[model samples]
Target: MSSIIKELVSDPHSSEIISLAVGMPDPFLYPLDVFQRILENMPATNPSDFGYIATEGYLPLRRTIAHMLSSNGIETTPERTLILSGAQLLVLPTEAGLNLEILEDYLIRYRPKLFYTVSTYNNPTGQVLTEQERRELLLLARRHRLVIVEDDPYSQLYYEEKPPLPIKSMDSFEGVVYIGTFSKTLIPGLRVGFLTGHSALIHRLALEKQYVDLHSNNFSQWLINFYLEQGYFEDHLNFIRSEYKKRRDSLVKAIRRYLENNVHFNVPGGGFYLWCKLKGTITSGRLLQEATKCGVFFVPGQAFNARPTEENEFRLCFASQPEPVLVEGVKRLAKALEILQKSKTPRKISESFLKPIV
Candidate 1:
C-alpha cells in the first residue's frame, strides 16, 4: 500500500472517525447566493443557450478567464484556454508519460515524470514554493522542453500576504500547462475549472474531451459567465479570504501552544492547511492512530510525497472547522501525544526477588 494509505489505515478506528485527510475547503464558506443568482439568470428563455457548447467551453467564460489570467501577468488569450471538470482531471491525464528529465533543476534526481504539484498551498502539505524555486522549475522545464503542469487552486485564499505569480506567468515558451479551479473560491458543485497552455495543445485536449463527454453543461457555463460579468466573484473571494484568515490564525496559535516543541511546521501564508513534522521515535502513522482514539484525525504527510521517505509528518486543516472546534481539537491531539510519550517510558523492576505464594 502507498505510505499515505498505510498511515490512514494505522488509525485506531480508521473505519469511523472525523477526517482531516481530505483537502477540500470548508463547505460553510461556499458562495451559495452568488451561484444561486448565476443559476437563476441562465437564459433558459432561449433554447440555443441550453444546447451543447464548443468543447473548449463557453466562449465568454473562456474570455473572462483569459482576461483574469492576463490581469495576473500570464499574457494569454481565450483561444489558449480549455475548461475542465476540475484541476486534477485536467492535470492527471495530460501529464501522464511526460518526461521530467527535461526540467532536471526543478526536480529531485529521481522525481517522477508526472508531478501532482500544488505550487501554492499544496494539498495536505500547504507548502507554497518560494519565488526562487518557481523560477528554477520554470527554467528547468524550458531547458528540457518538458511540460510543467501547475495546479493552483489555493493561490487566491492566502491569509498573510499576496500570493506569488503563478508559474504560468513565467512561461515564455508556453511550456507550462496551468490548471485552476473555482471550486475552492466559489461553490464546488459548479465543478468549474480551466486549463491554459499553447493553443495547439489546448485544441488537442478539447478534441479528446469531445470524444469523452462531448462538452461541459452549457447552462452551468452560461451561469458562470453571468456571474463573472456581474463582478460578484471578486467581492465573494475577498469575504472568504477574510474569514478563512481568521480561522487559520486560530489554528496556528492553538497548535503552537498545545503541541510539543519537537513538532515543527511552517505556517502557511495563504492556504488552508498546516503541515507538521513530529520529532523523536514517534511516526506520523502512530500519531494518527492515537489521535483517533482522542477524537482528532489528520492526514499523514506521506500522502503528498510521490515516494516514501524517513520523515514523520502530517497535515491539518484550519479552514474547515470553526475556531472553537479547532482549539479543542488541538488540545485533544496534545493529549494523544502525552499518551504516546508515557507509553515509551521504561518500567523499573525490583532488584530483589520475592518468594511465590502457594
Candidate 2:
C-alpha cells in the first residue's frame, strides 16, 4: 500500500520519472480558496473548537456526509454513521472484486460473516460492477444472511458514465455496510473517513475506536464541513473529473500507440487505473524491473490476487500525473515492455512486486 503512494513524492527518481503507479488526487487541483475561506472564518482562540468530541464524530460533519451519501442513493443518518481516523478493515482477500456466485460460494465454504468489495472503479482494475451484478450480490448476501461491506471512495470520480448505485444503496435487507473517504476526492493529507450501516455495527465500531484514540481531529472535520457548506466540494469534483478524463484519454491513446498489441486493456468509465494484461510471455515482475529502469513503475496484478500471481497483468494509474506526464509514462512502459520481450531469461523479482497498490 505504502509502496504505491511512496512513488508519488518520495521516490528517488521523482525528478526524472514519469510514474503512473499511484492513484492519488493531483495536489495542484486542490481548492486553496475553500481552505482559505474556512480558515478566515474559523473562530479565533475558541476553546470548544479544539475540545474532543464523541467518538462518533462531530454532528454537523456526520449529518452533511449522510446527506451527501443519501443523494447518491445510499440511505443513512448521522446516528448510523461512524467517523474514523482510518477505514474499518474488511479482510476478505479475493483475486478480484466479488462476483455473486463467487461470494455465495465463499459464504458456504467459509461461513464468513461478511463480504467486502470496492464495487465502483475498483482499485487496481478500474472495473465497475454492472447494475445486475450489484443486484445479484445483494440478493446473495440476503440469502446467506451475510454482511456486505462496500468500500466506495472512487465512485464520485467518474469519467464518462455514472456508475451503478452502490450495493449499499440497493441493499434491502440492511446487510450492507458502506464505507467512504475524503482522501481520494479531497487531499490525502486530510485523513477523514466514515462508515454507515446498522447502528449496532457502528456503535460496536465506535466503542472499539474509543480505545484506539479518543476521536479524530475535530479541526479537520470542521474544515471539511466548511468546505461542503461553501458548495465548493461539488465544483471541485466536477473540475477534477474533467481534468482526469483528459488524462484517461491520453493514457488510452498512448497505450494504443506505444504498447500496440503487446497488451490488452479496458478503458475505465471512472477511476484512476487502466488495468492491463500482457500479450507476450514476459511476467509482470520482469516488466516492472524493466519499466523501473526506464524511469517508470506500475503495480503488477499479482499483488491484488488472493490466489496465485497473474504475472502477465499490471495496473497503471492516470490520476496523479497530468496528460503530458501520463503520455510519457506510457511511452516508458512501452519501452520497458520491448526490453522485457527481447530478454531471453527472466529477471530477479523484487520484493516490492508483492506490495498491493490500493
Candidate 3:
C-alpha cells in the first residue's frame, strides 16, 4: 500500500494511474463550504477550549460521543472514553464472516495479549459479523480473559440496513474496548477520534497518551463537536451513503459485465470494497503487475492475510472515484486479467505485502 501510494505521489505519470487500493473518503464529497461557514461564525478567542485541556478529551465532545453511542445501543460515559488520534489494527482472515471454530483454536494456541477486529463493513473484505457471532466473540474473550479491541470505523457507512451492534455493546464482562472515528463520515484532517472502554483501562491509556501527543487537537475536537451538535452529521452521512452506494453499484455492474465468467465476488450491502477472486490460473500477483501496467491498481488479498497465501483474491474500492471512473477502472482490470490469462510465464510477488502500516 505504501509503495502504491509512493508511486502515485512521486511518479509524473500518476495522473493517468487509477488507484482503487486505498480506503479513503473522496475529497469531492468533503463539506468544505459548510465547514467554512461554521468556521467563519466561530469566536476568535476561547482560551479555555483552545488551550491544553484534560488528557481524556473535550468534555462536551466526550459527552456527545457517549450520547451517540448510547443511541446505537452501546452504553458509555465520558469517564469511560478517551480522545485519540486513531487506532492501530491488525487484520485477520475471514470468508463472508468470521469462523468461530478456527478462531477458538487460534486463541487457545496463540494466547494473544490482545485480539482486534473491524466487525462491521470490514475493510478490504466488506464483511460484517452477525449478532450471534459478536456475542460468541465476547463469550470467547470472557472465557479466556482475553482483551477484545473493537475498532469500528465503517459501521455508520452501511449502504442498506444497519449492521448488528458492535461486540462492545454486548460486552457483559467489560472485556471489549470500542474505538470510533470521524475520518470516514466527516473528514480525516479533523484528526479527531475516541476510545470507549472500562474507566480503569481508559485512565491508564490516558496517562500513556499524555507522554505521546499529550492530547488530540482541541480545535479539531471542538469543530467536530460543534458539527455534531448542529445536526450536520446525519445530513452529511445520508449524502455519503447515497453517493457511495451509486459508485458501488456501478463498479459491481462493470465487473459483472466484463469479468463474470473469469472472476467471482460478493456484492457487499455496504462499505467501500468488493472482495474478488479469479477462477483461473491467473494469480493475484500477476494480475496486480498487469493491472499496474494497464494504469489500474488494487490490493491483492496477500496483503490482508495473516499467513503467506497463494490465493487469487483481491480488493477493489469504489468510493474514491465517480461512477464513470469506477467503470473505466474495471474495464482496465478486465484487460489486465486478459493479459495475465494469455501470458505463458506469469510473474508472482517475490515478497509479502502484509506488513503493518502505522
Candidate 4:
C-alpha cells in the first residue's frame, strides 16, 4: 500500500485531524440508486451468481470493456482484455516533464523488457504527458522491443478539457498494454479493473491468475455489468465530476488564501492531488510533524521520488474530503507552516568555537 493511503486508513478519524493525504474518492458520491436497482432486479437467489467465472473474468464485462476501449481508439477484442486485481512498482526518467531523451537513454542502457507509466493526470504531480511525448515513448518502445504498460485510472475525472488520448490508442498500440478501472468511477469496494492488450498476452495472464484467486467476485461483476448496461455509469461519472470539481476549487481557493506566499503549486487540470513546493527551508518531514500538531496530515513528497529527495515538496489531496473540510485542511496546513517558520532560529557562531586557522 502507498504511504499516503496507509496514513489515511490508520486513525482515519481522529478528533480534530483533517487529512489531505489520500486520493480516496468521496464516499458521499456512492451511487446507491444504481446498485439498488441492480439488486432489485437480480434474482433473489441464483446459484450462477455465486459460481466461479472464467479466469479471464466474466465474458459480458470483458466484452463491455472491449467496446469501451475501442471507442477510446484502442482497438481490442474481449479476448485481449485481462482483468487484474492490483498493481505496483516505481522508477522513472530523471528529466522533468517525462523527458524522452533520458527515457531512450535509459531504455538503451537497461534494455528493460517492460516500461510502465501513469501517463494521464499522473498521481501526486497531476502532470499530464503531452501528445508529442506519448508518441515519442511509443516509437521508442517499438524500436527497442519493449512493452509499455499504461495504468490510467483517472482519465475520466478531469475538471478541464479531456486529456490526450491514451498511448494504447495509437496505431502502434500492439506493444502497449492499457489498464483501467471502475473502482474510481463507481466505488473502490467493487474491486473492478481491467487490462487491455494482445490476446496472446491476455491468455497467459489469465492462466497465471487461475492459480491465484480463482476469479474475482462474480456477484460484483454482475452488478458492474448491470450498471454499465443500464447506463448508470455515465450518469454517475457526470455527478462526481461536478462534485469533485467543486472540492478542487475549494482547496485551491483555501491554499491561495492561506499558504500562497509560503508555498508554490500548480492547480491540477484534473485528478486527486495538488503537489506543492515549499518556498522556505522547512522540510516536508518537519512540516508533516507540525501539520500533525495543527490537526492535519499529508504525505511528504520524498515518498514519491525515485532518487535522492529534496525535503521541501509534499502532496495534498482534495478528492476525499468535503469542500468545507478541504478548506479547513488547507488552513490547518497553513497554520503548521506558520508554526514551523516562527519556531526556527538561526544558529549563532560563538567566538570560543571559532579556532584561528594557521
Worst 10 residues of 1 by lDDT: 349-358
Residue 309 lDDT in model 4? 72
lDDT of 3 by residue, 53-140 (tens): 9999999899999999998888999999898875543233455799787567546744446878889988878899999999888888
**Which ranges in model 3 have alpha carbons more than 4 Å from their true place?**
1-4, 7-14, 43-45, 89-112, 350-358
Clashing pairs in 3: none
> Per-residue lDDT of 164-190 in model 2, one digit per residue for the tens?
889998877688989999888887777
Quote the lDDT for 12 in model 4. 43
Pick the winner on lDDT between candidates 1 and 4.
4
* C-alpha TM-score for every candidate: 0.82, 0.89, 0.88, 0.85
Overall lDDT per candidate, in order of appearance:
0.73, 0.81, 0.81, 0.76
How many collisions per candidate? 2, 0, 0, 0
RMSD of candidate 1 to the truth, in angstroms, is 9.7
Candidate whose TM-score is highest: 2
**Per-model root-mean-square deviation over C-alphas:** 9.7, 5.5, 6.5, 9.1
Better of 1 and 4 by TM-score: 4
Q: Give model 1's TM-score versus the native structure.
A: 0.82
Clashes by residue pair, model 4: none
Candidate 2 at 295: error in angstroms?
0.4
Total clashing pairs in model 1: 2
| Candidate 4, 225-307: lDDT as tens digits | 76787777777888888998999899889989988888889988888888899998887777877777788878778767666
